[model samples]
Target: MPLPTDTYRALTQSVSAELASLRASTPDVMKAFGDLGRAAMADGALDKKTKELIALALGVAAHCDPCIAFHTQALAKLGATRQEIDETLGVTVYMGGGPSAMYAASAIKAFDEAAGATRG
Candidate 1:
């Protein structure tokens, strides 16, 4: 079954508190991580949308729920359609096999929720 519409959002919110604490304790490391993320997602040969898609796929493959949530939210804001998300999930599953298939479901739920949140 798909996750609840608010699940990913809630998960992200919960993670944010812990992440904030970690960042407070490890400011330099957190800043470096944030910088890396910004640099990786910057528009270049590939646009931010495409980069987000790749990141979403990798997030699913890695079973990283927060990554999936963040990237799906990014993808939705970037105007990614459901078809695009599904196609990316297809590639993610093919590359990462059964485990990825599990997380891909969550990824789509994340996308849908984020898309709806943007609209509402």
Candidate 2:
């Protein structure tokens, strides 16, 4: 279920409209959440870019597709390179992520099964 990067643009736009409606329905909660986002993202010890990178890593690790789309879209707007994205995902995997689980499975299978025979 790989999505094209451009799909993120559409996803962000669609989610923005839904968020507006959500705010209308849950004004207090939405306002609080928005406030939290703004406060957290404001630059202090870390810049916004770093925060977004962290978010991207967390999103990938958590398997949150929408989070990935939103963060990648943000990173793109912030001038993130392919290297940055790749490194971020690399860190995410290093930190024990869904990607790590996938690779770990393959590693175990490879270890258990040689070219043609199974091992103990």
Of candidate 2, the 10-residue stretch with the lowest lDDT total is 111-120
Task: Write candidate 2's Cα lDDT for 36-106 as tens digits.
Answer: 99999889999988898788777767766567666766666666666666676677788976675553333
List residue ranges in candidate 2 displaced over 4 A: 1-6, 98-120
Q: Write model 1 residue lDDT over 1-120, tens digit each, in one string.
A: 443345888877878877998999999999999999999999999999999999999899889988898898888899999999999999999999999999998898889999998878
Rate residue 89 of model 2 by lDDT: 66
Misplaced by over 4 Å in model 1 are 1-6
Clashing pairs in 1: none
Using alpha carbons, what is the TM-score of model 1?
0.93
Q: What is the C-alpha lDDT of each candidate?
A: 0.90, 0.63
TM-score of every candidate relative to the true structure? 0.93, 0.73
